[model samples]
Target: MSAESPPGLDLARLRSRLDADRPGLVTGPLSARLIEGGRSNLTYVVDDGARTWVVRRPPLGHVLPTAHDMVREHTVISALGSTAVPVPPTVLLCTDDAVLGAPFYVMDFVEGTPYRRRDQLDALGADRTRRIAEAMIDTLARLHAVDHTEVGLTDFGRPEGYLERQLRRWGKQLDASRSRDIPGIDTLRERLSARLPNSPAPTIVHGDYRLDNLLVDDTDRVTAVLDWEMSTLGDPLTDIALLVAYTEGEALGDEISSVATAPGFPPVRDLVARYTATSGRDTSAMGWYLGFAFFKLAVILEGIHFRHTQGKTVGEGFDRIGASVAPLVARGNATLEED
Candidate 1:
């Protein structure tokens, strides 16, 4: 091993672990690069001079450890291997921090596009873009349709009071990152806290479900759902609300996160209707969920911003994360009040 290993990975040590655990998985010298960063765990594309795999690990010096449970992410994905939801095939899940400086998982590298910007969707054209968006929603409904107990996930998460815990958890996270006064943020929290709905029957919830969090293949179908660090047994409608909230927002700062803003993407109402039709669940009371989604995103960006300010954030795109928080908080307050 040289002194030039990447910040979050030690290729030599990784090779040793893979050899000891799985044997003959690597073919040649290993290489890696940070492929995703900012608010969530760090993702990297590591190659063995022949095959490539995606690796996920906690962000460098992340504030919360429980939120980035690599074992839980791997467990849910591995459990869903025989199910309808498309997830990258699991190759390895390593918890021994001595190998990579932290726990991480490796899975087969699936070929697809995350389609995070407007121009990317524009290139796909209106009809194709619409189809991909529909597929994204349909895939989510299908994921919600899976029975956790049958999939051996009966102990994955506590279904009872999931919403209340989320509200309280994200509220504390927001307070932890409060560097400046954010108008209407406290009011938004209060309203969500007061009007919390009795959650629907719990299912597998992808805590942050959005177009960018999914990979679409050439057929415009969702090839794989990435970033399952937040997946758990909880109110599945929360997943729908978060997706709709991200899709329907008019302003999410100056960032080019406009995959949902691309022309011809179906309206959020149509998405909600489609989900309700497919999932056979009542979503008339989703307004508060949408509000909570906005609040959750606001707090997430604030946490990223706080880390960026501390020089602890590892990659690009974090410069504007702080600026995006206030607008999201305001939108959350407005959404709750509108209903």
Candidate 2:
């Protein structure tokens, strides 16, 4: 492969990489534009001579270790390609730091919009909203149904202590991002750890399953599931619980007040019912998992809040994340106690 002078991640490098690996790869001059709104990673749309591609990489500035594993992200998506799940086709992976100043992966740029705001949800008609919601649940069910052994991911994560490790991991993250002691975080953490639910069998879990992390086509079908940084082998119910926490209940009502009052959005019970019917897993344990997901998200948001306070993140959403911490903790406690 002939190495050209590293261009400023413009058409030159994009074309060069594609040409080197996929000799007949047709593309257009790379016109790059940033896809704004994600708190964790930086995403860009790069159009080559004829086709558009997406490049995902870690955010700028200091990053935590193993936080953004591009290789793992690429691997999981590539593995899912043969499955019933819908995911963007991963085209190339660039591990060399010299290319983009960080490890990154390129995927077939999907032509769809990600719902980032409640307004976007409102604009989508009730029928489309319901279809998209059902699609999300179905996609997640298919994901959890994938056989890890067949996907060459039997060793994807240590499932022996999945819940325990998750509690510890986020607990450590909370400590690292501690700005001030929240009233109930410590107590919630203790209760969550003590009440860790039993696992049936380890299944692939999308750590951050939510409406915003997905892309929907004109038909309201989910075209791709984005942001696999926190995906791992664990109780798949955790994924369902996260979906519930972020979408179904009053928690989401608090996050997006307008949506809570909307007519189309399905309730938490209906979502759980759909998941139970599709996945056929005993969801009686869902309460514990829901609590855990809320606690985990609270810590992650708190981490962002910490970064924002340190001037690491420059924006409005992050600065307000701390406000959700207490509510999230309370929501978690409620889930644990829900009969």
Candidate 3:
């Protein structure tokens, strides 16, 4: 045992801790890889020859205090354990920084594909594609339908002023990451502020919900809804609207839109209708919500663009992100004009 940790993980330390806390949890040696190390949090997969588990921790180096709270992610997932929502089972939660130099949690590994391309769904055929899309919405409805109070999540977040706070928060994020002026960015933000829709009764708002964020098994079942770094009690419509925004852009030839171009993924209108009927919430002001979603996404992408400029970003799509921003801000303004 050389006491050397593989890149992004102190496997030796992790193994020692697991052996001390829960003996037999890790049999044999351990290897880990940083699977998803993006804006929200860094995720890794650890395998012990026979069994595997997923690990989540804050991004290396610069970390936003409230953005990637391991305990918050652990808390929400643990709370949703009994709900119809399919989340990976928690194996262990370690908040102590000594074990891994940062707080992290381990959960049962979920086997599923996070469909991020229309071509991927196209291979599944239209029927299966539609089924998966429908399941995504149904699961979202089921999640929103959960009574937070009864689930002991009443204090998970302060739902009051959630939407307003979100607007201010993202605006600050954008300003902090600003490198250049984005056309129509301020206009879109101002319009969203001017016409803030009266939010419905708050439910769990998965801050960044979309197809790629969900894992669908071969049976077309959403085995787990991954990425709870942004989960909180807030206007549920924000989640739905972000879904619509991504699909809407994809349908318009936007590369980052990712899904919704398949033959039978169902129309955005149908999806909205399904959510309305399933969740029993009025979606009349979805246009405003969708526009707000666009603004939020534009800001997010711009922040990524800034990071990429500073050579702080990892991955391939950074070059195209700045190109995506102006169009999104423009679309956000246009979407608000809809009836």
Number of the top-ranking candidate, with TM-score as the measure: 1
Report how far off residue 105 is in candidate 2 (Å).
0.7
Best by lDDT: 1
The C-alpha stretches of model 2 lying farther than 4 A from their native spots are 1-28, 248-261, 314-316
Worst 10 residues of 2 by lDDT: 1-10
By lDDT, the candidates rank as 1, 3, 2
TM-score of each: 0.96, 0.89, 0.93
Runs off by more than 4 Å, candidate 3? 1-7, 36-39, 251-255
Query: Which pairs clash in the backbone of model 2?
Result: 27-48, 27-49, 27-50, 28-48, 28-49, 28-50, 29-49
lDDT of 1 by residue, 1-339 (tens): 233457788888988988999898898888888775336788878888789888888888746636788998999999998999999999998999888888999999999999888888898799998899899989999999999999999999998999998989888888777778888889998998999899888899989888888899999888899899888899998999988777766457535267777887888888999999988999998889899999988887778888888888887788878888788888888887788
User: For model 2, how does the per-residue alpha-carbon lDDT over 213-249 read when each residue is reduced to its tens digit?
Assistant: 8888888888899899888899898898887777643
* Alpha carbon lDDT of each predicted model: 0.85, 0.77, 0.83
Q: What shift in Å separates residue 10 of candidate 1 from its native position after superposition?
A: 1.5
* Model 1 error, position 207 (Å): 0.5
Q: Where does candidate 3 clash, by residue pair?
A: none
Lowest lDDT block of 10, candidate 3: 1-10
